[model samples]
Target: MGSTTIGCDQRIAWLLTSARLLNPDPELARRDGFIKALADQGIKIDNSRISRWESGLHPVSGQVAATYEQALGLTEGSLVAVAAGLRRTFGNGPAPREGALRGADLTDGDMDRLLELIDEGKGTGAHWLRLVGQLGTYDRVYLRQQEWAALSARLVQELAVSVGVGFVRRYEAAAGLIRHPNAQRHLTRAIGGFVMNPDTQVVAPVLSLLTEIADEAAGDLVLRMLTSEDKNLRSAASSVAAVKVSRGHFGAHALPQLESHVVGSLRRGESLDGRLDSFDLAVQLPDESWERAMGGLRNRRAFDLVIGSRRGGELVPTQQTAAVVQRLSAAVQRDTPTHSPHENDAMLRRLLRESLLHAHKPRRHHAALLLAATPYAPAVAKHCQDLATHSNDLMAARALTVLMRVGHRMGRSRVLLQSLAETRPTIRARALVNLGLNPEPIKPAEADALLGHLDEHSRPVERHATMFALGMNGGTTLKKLAKSDTEWMARSATWWLDQGPALHDSDAALDQIGAQT
Candidate 1:
C-alpha cells in the first residue's frame, strides 16, 4: 500500500467545520471565529483559506495541514479524511460526522459528577488513589485536584503511618506538586501540627498525617524549617519527623525527608551554640538487604545540600550543611546494623572522599569516623590517613578506633600494624590495649611500645585500652606483658582475652572493656 498526502487548506476547512460540530457550545467555532481563534494561537490563516478549500478552488499545503492537525489536536490522517468529507459535503451541508462529540464535550453536570466521585470521603479517597495510579491520568488538572484535600486527609487518618506515608508520597510524586512553596507552607503547618503534638500516642498515625502533608511538599524549602531554632519546636518536631533513608520504593521520598530533618536539627544546634542535644540522629535501616541497595547511590543532592550549609559555599543557604553531614554520619556510624553490600560500598566510597577533601571540621570529623568503621579498601585509604593526621585530638582518636575496626574486619594484620604506627605514643598505647580484646599477632616493637605505656602513663583508662588491644593482637605479647613492671596490666589483658567474644556477648566487647577495666 502507498501513502497519500492531504492538502493543508482542505484540512483546515474540515477541522474548523468538525470543531464547530463537536463543540456543544456553538460559540467555539462560530463562522470565521474559528479562524480568528487559530490566528490568536499564533497560527496564521483566514476564512478565505477555508472557503477556497471548501469551494475546491485550492488544495491545502503540507505546512497548513500540520498546523491544523496540531491546533485541533487530531491525528493527521483523521484530519485529512474529515477535510475530504467536508469538501465532498460542503454544498450538501455540513457532514453528519461533524456533529459528533468526544468525551471532552461532557457537560458541566458531568464535571460535577466526576468531582463528586473524588470528594466522596471514604468512598472517593481510594478511587482517586486508584485513578492516579493509571498512567497519564495524573496530567489532568481537574482530575488531580478533584478530591485532593479530602482524599489526602482521609488517607492520612486511615492508613498506618508508614503505609499512608508511602501512598501520599507516591501521589505527590505523580503530581509533581512538591515544588510549590505556598502548598509546602500550608502542608507543613497542617501536618506538622498533628505530628508535633507531644501528647500524640500512636506515632504511626501522627507520622502518617505528617507524611500526607509532606507529600504535597516533599521537595519544598519548608522542609528546612522542620528543625528550626524554636527550642521547643525542634525538640518536639524531631520525634515524629525523624526518618531513615532505606533503599527502595520508600527511598525516593523518605530519603529527602530524612535529609531535611537531619539538616534542620543540625542548624538548630548551631544556632544555640551547640547546646541543643536531642537531634534524632539515629537511623534504622530496613534490613541488611536494603543496605546494599540504598548504600550504593551517592545521594549527591543531599551531600551537596549539606556541603553548601558549611561556611563558604555556592548553593543557597541551606542551614548548616556540615552539621547535617555530621548528624547523618553519626547516624550511619551509631545506628546502621546492616546495609546491602552495594549500598555499603557506595556509601563508604563517598564518605571517604568527602571526608578527606571536606574543609569543614565537624563534617570532616564525622566522615573520617565513618571511613574508619568501613572495611579497609584502597579507595578509602586516604580517609583513614586524613583522620589519623587530623589536628583535632578527639577526631584523630575516633579515627584510630575506626581504623582498628576496619583492619579487624579485613583480617589484615598489616593495616592494623600501620595504623598503630601512625599514632602518637600515647594514642598507640591506648589503641594497643583496645586490640588485645581481639588481639592479632603484633610485632615485637609494637608490643614493647604498648608495654611501656602501662608504667609510663598515669591514666588508667589509656593504659587499659592499650593492654586490651595488645592482648587481642595475640601472640606471646600478653605473656610478655606478664613480665611488666606491674603485673596488673598483663592479668587484665589475659582475663579479657580468655573471655574473648563471650566476655560480653549480649553487649559490645569494646564498650564492655571500656567500662569494666
Candidate 2:
C-alpha cells in the first residue's frame, strides 16, 4: 500500500493510510469525507486531526483506533492492537492509557478466544507440538471446567502416537505442566507405551514425563525397566530414581572425552571457562563412594556432589568456588599433607587456563564448566576479559557470564551490547537474558534490535526468548504484547508484565532456561 516498506513507528499509521487509499468507496474514505463517515459512526474527529495521526505526528485514542479499524472494514481492535505493539516496540507516539492491556488473569472471553484458536489449529500436528512451548510459559492456563475433559482427552490421543524428537521434547515440556487428574490418567496410559518403545530418543524424554504423571501401578511397569538390559532405558530409569549410571546412554561418547580433556588440563595445571561453555560440556563425576581418580584434586567432593544432585544440570561459578574454598579450609584443619591445602584449587585454575583457548570446542566446554565452578585466578581473569570480545561468540558469551560473576561488568558493557547481535540463537538468547538481568539502561539501537527480533510469527523458542529479553530489559510497555494474537507469547508477556519480571533471572538460571531445546 505504501511506496516503501514501513519502518517500526509507521506500522499503525501506514495501516491507516493504506486502509483509506485502498478503500473501495473513495467518496467516503478520504480524510474529509472519512471524517463525516466516522462522525456518523459517533467517532468525532476532524479531517486535519486524522491527517496528523496518518502522518505519524500523533496517535488516536484506543476507541478511535478501534473505530478506524471497523470503519475501514477491518477487524475490530486490529489497529488498536498494532498501534500498541508499535508503541511498545518503538516507543513511538504516546502510550495507550484506557485502551492499554492490564493484568495477567484471563477473562472468560479470553479463555473462549483461546479455545477457538486451539480448535482452528488442532487439525495440524504442529498445533499440538506448538502448544508444548506455548502453554509451558504461561503462569497458568485456564480452561473453563467444561472444556477440560475433552481437551485433555484430545491431548492424550495426540501424545499416544506422536513421533520425532522435536515432538517428544514439546510434549515432555507440556506433560510436565499437566497434573490434573483427568489428564494424568489418559497420559499415563499413553506414556507407558512410549517408555517401552525401542528407540532411545523416544524412551528418554517419555521417561521424564512418565515420572510426572506416573502412578503406583505405573511404578510396577517402570520397575521392570529398572532391571532391563537396555542401557538407555536403565539410564532413563536411573535418572528418575535420582541415581547414577556408570555410563549413561545419552552423551556417553562425549563424557569421557570431556573428562579426559579436563584431566589432561589438570595434569598440566590449567583450564579456561570459555572452553567449557561453547560445546554444552557437562560431565558427572563419581560419588565419594567410588572416589575421584585424581586424589590430589581437593574440589572433587564438591564436583561430585554438584553434578550428583537430581536437579544439578550444569555447574555455576559461585557454588563451585565456594565449595572449593570450603574443601581447602577443611584440608588445612586436618593437617592434610598430600600437598598445599590449595594445591587442588591451584590445579583447578591451571586446568581452566590450559583449556581456555583450546582449538577444540568439546574440550573448551569442559574447561569452561570447570573454570566457572572453581575459584577465579588473575591469570585466567585477563583471558576472560579479553575473550569478551573474542571472534568466537560462545567464548564471548561465556566470558560475559564468568566476568559478571566476579563483578567485572563495567568495562564489558559495549561487548555486552555486541553480544545482543550474535548470529547464533543460543548465544544471542543467552546475551539477551544477560541484558535483561543487568541493570543497564536500554539504548535505542539495542532497543530496536530487541523489538525487531520479537515477531509473533517467529518460532516459539525464539519468540519466547525475545519476549523475556525485551520484558526483562525493563521499562517496557507490554500491554500490546500481553494481548498478542500468539497465545503463548501473549500469556508470556502478560505474565511478565504482571509478575514474571520480578523473579530472579541469574546467569545460571537463564542458562538453564535458554538452553531449553
Candidate 3:
C-alpha cells in the first residue's frame, strides 16, 4: 500500500482560508491585517512574502507556520501538520478514519470498556499515550458534533483515571477539551463527588484543570475550595491559583479577589497542609513559572505573585498546623480504657516526648497540656515538669499551667516561686494565677503574701491577674477585690466570685485577664 499526499500549496490555501473564516475580525483575512497579526506575535515578514504564500507562488515555511498558528489561536502544529500532509484541514472538519469516533456512537458500556483498558494500561507510558491520544481524538469529534453531554461524561471518567495515574499531559488534554458549558457542568459534578468523598489523588489535577479554564465560575469554585476544611482540597486550590496567576490565566479583574482571599486565609492562620509539595510543583512547572512570575513585574506591571510571597520564610507552625498534636492528644485520652496499663503508659510517654521536641511551639504546648489533662503518669508528669522549668517563657508558662491544673504541687519549686517575682508583669501574673489555681492547700500566710504583692502593682493587667488569683483562693479577698477601685478589676473580680472556685488554669484564663484589662 502507498500513502496519499496533499500538495503543500493546496494545504496552505485550505489552512489560510480556514484561519480567515474562524477569525472574528474580518479585517484579519486581508494581507495588511494578517501581516500586523504576524508582527503582533513578533514575526516580521515582508507584506509581499505573506501574499506570495497565499497566492501559491511560495510555500509556507516552518517559522511562518508556527507564527500563523499562534497569531490565529489555532492548535499547535495544525498548520505544519497540514503542510506536511499529516492532516487535511482545520476548523472542526471531519477527522481521518483512523481518528474518527463519534460521541453519539459510544454507549455507557463502551465508555466503561475504554476506562477499563486505560486502567489495564497504567504505568506503561506508551500505552497510556496511545489511549489518551485516542481519547483526545474522540473528544474533538464529539465537540464538533456538539454532543456535549456524552463527551462530558466520557471526559469525567477519563479525568478520574488520568489523575489517578499522574498522567498530567493526558489530564491536561482532557481538561483543555472541556470548553463547552455542558462539559463544564459535568466536570463540576465530578468535582462535587470528590468533595463529598475526597480522594486526594484527583484533587491536584482537578484543581489544575479548573484553574486552567479560568472562567468566572471556575474562579469562584477555586475561591470556595481555598476556604475548604479539607486540607488536601485547600492545598490543591492554592497551588492551582498560583499556577494560574503565574501563567497570566488569572484575569486582572479576578486577581484582586484571589489575592484578598489568600491574604485573608494567611491572616486567619489557615494551614495549607501540603504547602511544601505545592511549592515544589510550582517551582517545577517548566521554566515558564519563574519567567511568568518575573514577567508580571517586567511587562505587566503587576506584583510578582508566587507561593514564596505568601510564606515569608521558614515553616512557622501555628495552632492550625498542629494537627498531629490534636490527633495524638485525642488518641491518648480515648485509648487508655482499651489498652493495658504498661501499653498506655508507653504510648503516652512516646507521644509526649515526640510532641515536646517538635520544632513548633504550639505543638509542644499542646503535648504538655494533653499530658496534664490525661490521667497521672510519672513519665508524663516528669516531662511536663522539665518543660515547665525551661527558659522559654511561653513554654514554661503553658507547662506550669498544665501542672497546676493536674494538681501537681509547685509551692516549693524554685522555678515557680521565682516566676511569681519575675520583673516581666505577664510572667509574674501567670505564675501568681497558677499558684492560686493549685489544687493542693496553700497556707494562709502564702495566700496573704500573694494578695499583698497585688497591692504593690498599679498596672491594670497586674490588678486583673491578682483578682483572678484571689478569686481562685475562695475567701474574703475575692469579695474585697470584687469591690476594688479599678472598674475592670472589680468586674473581673465579680465574675470570678460569681463563678466560684473551679479549676480555671490555662492560657484561656490569661487571655481573659488580658481581655478584661
Candidate 4:
C-alpha cells in the first residue's frame, strides 16, 4: 500500500492555519506571542521553531503538536492526528464529505448538514452504508466531546422520521465508537430519549445496543421498558434482554425483572399470546413455574398443607389444586431433606409415585425430577426405567435424565450404557452428557465408541451434547471436534473446553445449543 503520510511542510502549514483560527487572540499567531502563550501553558517551545513551522521550513513533531493543542485549548490528538496524516482529509475549512469534524470546530450548522445527508441516505442500501461509515468517522472524533447536546438534538430529529433506518444505523455506529464511560453515558441518554416513544421498530435496536454496552447501568431503564403498557415496547425489551442475557451479559441482574413480568403474568392467569414460551428458555429462572403456582395457592387450602399441614384442620380436597400442591410438596421435600423429618421421605416417595401416574405431562416430569433426588428404591428405579421408555419425547427425556442421575448415584452403569444405545439423538445425547457427569470414569474403549458415533453432519443440538460429553470425559476427540469447520460444533467444543470441569447450568447449556441453531 502506498504511504498516505503528508510531507512535514504540508502538515506544519495546516497546523499553523488551524492554530491561528483557534487561538482566542490574533496576536497568539505571531512567533513572540505564540511562544509566550506556550510558556504560559508550561511548554518551552522557542519562537524561532514556531516561525520555522509556519514558514513550512520543518514539520511539527508529535510533542510540539500536543503542546500546541494544550496551549490553544484544541481537542487532544486533533493536531497530532493532522501532523501524522492520520486524518489527512480534515482541513481548517468545512469538513469534507467523507472526513470528520474536529470536536472543537464542529458547529450547529455542520451537525445539521450531517443530519441532512443521513436523511437523504435512507432506503438506499449503498448510500446508507456509506453514511454509516461517515457517521462512524464523525463519532471517532466528537463522541467524547461536549458536542453531545448538539449531536443528540440532531439524532432526535433524524429519529422523528417515520422510518428511522438512517438514524438507527448512525446510533449503532456511534455506540460502537464509544470507549469512555462518559461517552457511553451521553449516548445512553440520547438513546433513552426514544424509549418512551411508540416507534418500537426504531427504538428496539437502540435499546438493545444500550443494554449490551452499558451493562447494569441500563438495567433500570430496560425494566421500565419491559413493564410499559405498550405491548410493542414490552416485547422489544424482552427480546433485547433475551439476547443480552443469553450472551452471559446483564442476565444475572435482569432475570428477576423478566421472570416477574412473564411468570407473574402467567400466575395471574393472563394469556401472553405464547410470548412466555417463546422467551429464551435457557435463562428462565429454575422452579419459576412451581414458584408461581405456589404463590397463586397462598390463600387456598392446598397452600396451608404445603406450608405446614393444617394441624387438626379438616383437609378439604380441592381436586386439581390439591394435586398440584401434592406434587410441589413432594418436590419441596426432596429439595430440603434435612428440614423434612424421616417420615416425610416416605410420604414424598408415595407422592412422587402417584405424581408419575398423573395424566399431566408437567406433573409426570416434575415427579421424575423429584424421584431422581429421592433415596434409591426398586420401585423408584422401575418407575424411572418405565418412564424412560415412554412414547412422549419430553417426558421420556426427563425420565432418562433422572434415571442417569440415579444410576450414577447408585453406581449402576447398565441403565446409562443402555441409554447410550437409544436410537433417538436427543436421548443418546442426554445419556452421554449425564454419563460424563458421573464421578466414575468410563473405559477408553467405551468412550471411543461413543465418540465414533458422532459425525460432522450431526444436528447442532446433538453435536452440542456430544461435545459436552467428550469435554467432560477427556479425550483427543474434543480437540478434533473443536477444529471442525462446522460453526456450532466448533463453538460448542470451544465452550466446553473453556468451561473445563465446571458444570454448565441449564441456561448456559441451552444457550450454546440455541446459538448454533
Candidate 5:
C-alpha cells in the first residue's frame, strides 16, 4: 500500500475502538476468533493484522476495511474521522477548510434550499434514518470550538420543531460533541440554548438528552428547569416528569435499574462519608417508589441482607440494587432467610427505634419508612418536622416526602400544610411537591387557597404544583390555570377542562371536586 493508504489503518483502529467503547466484549469475537474466522474464509490474514486493527497498526485492505465498516455500521466517510483523530493527536492535520461545515450561517433561505434539494419521496422512516446518519457525521466535524457555534445554531433553528425524533438525533449529535474534548464547552452552551428556547417544540428530546447526561449539577439544573413557571418551558420538560414518575415507580420491571442507579448512589464511597448531596443520576427509582422497591416481595431478601447483614451498608456489596432487590425480595418472601429472620426483624426494629431517638439526623429511606410504619406517630411526626426544617435541601425534600406519605394516613395533612405555609422557601418548595402529590381531593375553595400560592411565590415547583392542583379542582380556577404562565400546568389544565364537562353531571364527580364554596 502507498503512503496514501495511511488513513485506512487509522480508520480501522478508530472503528475497532468505537465498537469496544459501546460493547467492550463483542461476544462474537473472542481470543483467536477473528483469525480463525478469517482463515475459514480463506483470507489467511496474519494475527498481526487483527492486532494492528485493535492496536491501530497498518492501513487495512479495501476489502477488509469494507468488512469492518459493515460490521460496525459506520456511516459514509467515517474513516475520515480517523484522519481527524490523527490530526488531533499528531498535530499533522488536514486544512481546516476541507472538512468544516460550509456556508455556516444557514438562514431560513438556506434551510429552504436544502429542503427543496431533497427528493420528497423520502418517507418519514427514511428521513429519520438519514437524519441519524447525518448526525453521526455532524458530530465528527461540528464539535470543535470555531465550528460548533455556527453548526449548532443552524441545527437548532432547522430541526427544533421538524419532528420529535429529530430532536433525539440532535441530542445524539450533542452527545458526540460532549465526548470530544475540543468541542464540549461550545456544544454544552449550544445545547443549553437549544433546550431553553421557548419556541422549541422538541422538549422531550432535549429532556431525554439532559437525563442521559445528568450528574449532580446537571440533575439540579433539570429539576430547576422542570419546575419553571414558564408554560412553554414546563411543557417541554414533560419528559422530566415522565422520568420522575418512572424512576419512582418501583415496579417489578424497574427494580433492577433503580437499585443499580439509586441505592448504589447512596452506598457509593462518596456517600459513606455523608458528602453526596444528590442521587439524581445515580438512582433510576423515584423518591416515592423506594418503599415499594425495598418492601416489595421481590426485594425482601436483599432488603433483609442490607438491613440485616453487617456487610449491607458497605458500598461495593450492594452496588446494583435491582438484581439484589429482586433476588432478596424473592428469597425473603419464600421464607428462606439469608440470615435468621427473627434476628433480622429484631435488628430492623432496633434501627427504627434508634432513628426515632436521633430523628434530627439525616435519615435514609429505610430508617424513615420504619419510623412511619411504627406504632408511634408523635415521634415520627416530630422527626418528620425536623427533617422538613433540615438545612440540607435534599434532606428537607426527603423529610417532607416521608411526612406527606405517612401524614395523610394519620390524618395530619391539614396540620402539615399549616406548618408548611410558615416554612422557609426551600422547604416550602418541597412541601408544595408533596401537596400536589396528595391523594385526597381538596375543595375548589381549598384548592383555590393552594392555587392562590401561584401569585405569591416565585419558585417554579410551587407554581407548577399550585397550577396542577387548580386544574385538578374545577370551575373558574381551572380556566385561570389553563392560561397560567407555567406550560406544564396549562397543558394539564387544558386536559382537565376537556374532560371535566363530561363528568360534571355525576354526583360522585361533583363530590370529588375540590372543596366547593
Candidate 6:
C-alpha cells in the first residue's frame, strides 16, 4: 500500500521473463548479463534485487521500468505501462479481481483466432461489415502486415462517406484499437489519409477519431493540414487541434497552446474542447510542465507510465479498462451539487463537470469513472443535469451514466430504474448492465424481469455483458443462471457468485483505481 511498496504481479513477471529469454544477444539474455546491462545504465541492483523482480516479489516502475526496457532492448514505457495498467486490476490487495487475468484476457491463441476470422471474412462484404463491427469492441489486437493493410483500407473506404450507425461503429472500433502497438501504425495512416481527404461526410468523424488518439504525430499531421484551401478542413482541424506554430514534436512544443484551452475552460466554467483533456497534456509534456498547465492539475499517480509517458498514454486504454467502462452504468436522473467545504473538492467537481461536457463521447463517459474512482461522498448525484439531456445522444447517455453511478453510491436507483424502460437496445442494455451497481433491494418481480429480458437479448455479446451485471446483483436469477445459460455464462455466473457481493459506497475502494486506464 505504500507508494514504494513492491508487489509481484503475474502478468508483469511473465512479460519480463519472456523479453529476456527472447533477446538475440546471448549475454543480454543471461541473468548475469542482464544485471550488468542494468548496472551500466546506473541501476545498482544485485542478484537478489534482480531476482526479486524476476520472481514477482517486486514490480518495476518509474525509473527502474525504463531501465529494464532499455537493458532488454524493448521500447521505452513498455514495462512501465504493464506495471501502471495492472495496478488497478492486479494490485497487491485483498480483492476478488486482484488475481491474474482470465478468459477476457487476450493471448496468442485469441489473436491467432481473430486474425483467421479476419482472413476468412475478407472475401465477403457482409462478413467484413460484421468483422469490423465486432473488432470495434476489442481494445487490443494484432494484425499481420497484410491484414492491417487490408483492414485499414476497408476502414477508410467505409468511413469516407459513412452515415449513422456504420460510421459510429467502425470509427469507434478503430479508435479503440489504438491501445495495441501493431494496430496504431496502420490506424494512424488511415486517419491521416481521411484528414487530408475533402469528403464532408467524414469531417466530424475524422475530428472525433483524432480526438480519441491524439499524439505528437497526429498533432503534427493535423497542424500541417490547417493551411489547405478547403474551408471545412480548416475549421474542423483548428477546433480540435488548435496550437501555436511549433517546429518539432508539435504536441509537446506547443503544449502551452493546447493546454490554454483546458485552463480557460476550468477558469471560465465552460466545457473543454471535445478533442482534448489534461491527461493528454501530462503524457505529451515533461513532468515539470504539470504545474504551469491549468495552474497545476495534479493527480497523485500522474507519473505512472500508462498515465504519463507518450507511448503508454497514446495507446487506447488497455482492454480491461475499456471493458470496465462499458460496465459502469445505464441510468438517468436529476440534480444536486456535492457541497464540499474543501476547495480541492470544489476544484475536482469543476474538473469532472467540464470533462463530462466534452463532445467526445468516450471522454464524457469517463466522468462516471472519475467520480467512481474519487473518494467523494454519496451526495454528488445528477450534478450535471444540463448534460444529461444534451442534443448528442451519446453525451446524454454518458451524463446519465454519471448519475447512475453516483446513485449507486447513494444506494438509490431512480435514474437507473427509469432508464430500463428505454426502448433502444443500447440504452436498455446499458441500464441492465448498470443495475448490478445499485445496492438497493430489488423486488422479485423486477429481478425476474431483468433475467427474462437479459435472456431474450439477441446479441451474444450483449447477453454476456448483462451476465456480468446480473452476477454483480446476485440473487435467485444469478443462482439459477449459474446452473443454466451457455457454459461460459453459467461458469461466469458461478464465478461472480463467489467473488462476493457488490461493493457499497462506504467502501471507498475505487479511489486511486482506474483513473489513468
Candidate 1's error at 357, in angstroms? 13
TM-score of structure candidate 2: 0.31
Scored against the true structure, residue 107 in model 4 reaches a CA lDDT of 45
lDDT of 2 by residue, 280-367 (tens): 2223334431234344334554335334431333333335345443443344223322222233334343334323333323233333
Question: Can you give the TM-score per candidate against the true fold?
Answer: 0.27, 0.31, 0.30, 0.32, 0.30, 0.32
Cα lDDT over the full model 3: 0.45
Off by over 4 Å in 5: 1-383, 390-395, 410-420, 471-476, 483-489, 495-517
Show where candidate 2 strays beyond 4 Å.
Answer: 1-348, 351-382, 392-408, 441-445, 454-462, 486-488, 502-517
Global fold similarity of model 6 (TM-score):
0.32
How far is 260's C-alpha from truth in model 4 (Å)? 17
Per-residue lDDT of 57 in model 3: 42
| Higher-TM-score candidate of 2 and 5 | 2
lDDT of 1: 0.38
Between prediction 2 and prediction 3, the one with superior lDDT is: 3
Reference-based lDDT, residue 7, model 4: 33
Task: Give the local distance difference test score of model 5.
Answer: 0.40
The local lDDT score (0 to 100) that residue 117 gets in candidate 1 is: 51
Candidate 5 RMSD to the correct structure: 20.6
Worst 10 residues of 2 by lDDT: 508-517
Q: What is the per-residue lDDT of model 5 for residues 217-298, given as tens digits with 9 covering 90 to 100?
A: 4445555564565544643344343344333422354334444333433443432112122232222244445555454324
Residue 280 lDDT in candidate 2? 20
TM-score of 3: 0.30
Model 1: lowest-lDDT 10 consecutive positions: 508-517
Candidate 3 per-residue lDDT over residues 347-427, each given as its tens digit: 354335434433222223333433432233333344445556556554555445454433344343543464456655555
